[model samples]
Target: MPVPRNSKTTGSKQLRPGKAGAVENARPEKEESCQAKRSPSSPQGAPKKRSAFGDLTNAHKNQAGLRKKDATKAGPRKAQKGTAALGVLKNNEINLKKATRKTPPDEASAEPKLVPKNDPVLEEPAPVQAPAIEDIDKEQLGDAYASAEYAKEIFNYMKEREEKFLLPNYMEKQYDISRDMRAILVDWMVEVQENFELNHETLYLAVKLVDHYLVEVVSMRDKLQLIGSTAILIASKFEERCPPCVDDFLYICDDAYKREELIAMEMSILRTLKFDINIPIPYRFLRRFAKLLPLPWSQCAHASMETLTLARFICEMTLPEYDYVQESASKLAASCLLLALKMKSLGGWSPTLEYYSGYSSHELHPLVKRLNFLLTYQHDDKLKAVRTKYSHRVFFEVAKSAPMDMLKLEVALKS
Candidate 1:
């Protein structure tokens, strides 16, 4: 046996108890103890606690904490991937909201568009403003004709027919105008209407014929009102039933026009149109063709009126035989509306189709396109100087949509 310490060894001699007594004697004095390893020392002057048995302790405990840092390093690649995935999911949710939301029109708060409000296609297209000089020889004024003398000669010839000759007895029931003057008035009226942005169709046609007849007999500046009035009168006879009388014409002048002057001019114009009262205008042709094309009546009416406005600009418009008007009414009307709406700086023809057709404007595109092509051919560059093209004699004296309440005048001796 190993040699024992003197008093310390003797004190440790309490051993070898019975098995049951030994188990009871082996119970711990503390509740629970940690398995501690080597322990670090506390700082100087820090309080330290000792074990009850004075044994070196092996237990350790950790306290959660964040260290003071200069900068937090970014996470590992896997951690970064998880963050990116979260961001992507957030972005997807945002995209879904955008896809489903209904955005209002940019100008949805504005008032309803009157003209075609979509596809506003306009360039700075200044209309070819024909000269204010009514007497420009068609050859010099418009490209359609040449030879100023021919233009003047034609004017005189037409004037002579109205002034010196009487219509044949059989054709007395017809309305007539200076043949050459007729087309000139129509063409110029169209041009003027375009410039002024006035959309009165009846006014254009009436002014055209009036202006023409005024030039036909004599451009007597003093008799201008009479010419304008007489031209309107003839147009009234053609365009409206129960045509206005001298008194009504005077009232329309707002007392500025005179009765005797209009009466005298009326007689002169009557002689020129040869009293063949049944001169048909494009308005009639428009109604017939608009029906033929199955265009909406109101829309077609607007179109025909537009054609009549354009007629004021067409040189040949004055001589509209029934066949000519029938052949080109659709194209002419559409061109007028297009040019008019374009000048107004509104959207293209679709709005018109929507308003008039009760459907989207797209449906009328094919017809509108075809009509555009047809009008394009009508503008022949070679005819710019034509004698009859430049003069204003063929159209009305004043363009005002003729009044509906005109009184019928009995120009001929009552049978």
Candidate 2:
């Protein structure tokens, strides 16, 4: 059995019935203090002790927050994949743009830029066509030694070079030396060629050097032999494979000039000529014309060689003659060949000769006539070195061959 007591006197302060009911429905104060003590983020002082009820209460609240965040993250799977793919594509596009900015375009693979129609660079000039000439070197095309492919071009270039080196009547410009002295010097140079066994080109170029040097400088008669010997030395160096030494030229000059004098003269001659001693010679032109003849008349090959020798003899005769210094090597060679052909009774200047020599029979008439006159009146004994050289059996005695008659030579030239 339980005893009942009055509410106001139950060993405590009494509250009205409504107030006590409100207190019974409210949260406990101890629970609120425990939560505040566990939380340092609270406005109260530093946390003291953790109560078990406080731990359980915080765990329940954390679980509710986590569930809300999980629901937000549960988006469509396709949308997430699409966003990632779009971001990758944007990065790739940016990288490609950077690469394009760094690398230059390849020339061979790139398109050619279009040139404006009115540009002067686009307006190409027409090529100047060379004249049509006979193909004389066609047979020698297989002979690499012949240089057949560039023969025409080579000769054409030589002809063009002739105009640049035109010699004037420089004899009148000198005071001490005369044309006759010049002739005597040339005669001696021929003897040097024979003695040294030097090439005929060396002799010709030596003579040319003397004449060219005489044109620019005045020399006394005493030093004439020195000048001639030095000229030979210079030409030998230019044209010979095994040119004689400076001592050899001094010995050849009969020790008349000192070694230093000859060397000084050589330097002076080269300086006066500007070191351009590659003057075209008649021998080269004559040989080229001779080649053209044998092709047309292969049967007369032996006779042609003799005739070439005769032509060379005639050409050599004019080297000492001051009157022919102004003559271009090509034209002089052509006239000499014409005279030889006339003397041999070979067909007068054919189309092949005319094309290669660049001289028609009529155009060469005056020079040919003069060349015949030169052979006709060969009475100069002092200048007989060329004649004596060609008269040998080794040269086929072409010098002993008789000259063509005057009237017959005229007829040949006219034809």
Among all candidates shown, the one with the greatest TM-score: 2
lDDT of each: 0.36, 0.73
How close is every model to the real structure, measured as TM-score? 0.28, 0.66
180-296: candidate 2 lDDT, tens digit per residue: 888888888887776555667778889888888888898898888888899888987887655778876776665688988988998899889998888888877887787655333
Candidate number with greatest lDDT: 2
- Full-model lDDT, candidate 1: 0.36
Candidate 2 clashes: the total is 0
Worst 10 residues of 1 by lDDT: 29-38
User: What CA RMSD would you report for each candidate?
Assistant: 50.3, 50.4
- Pairs clashing within candidate 2: none
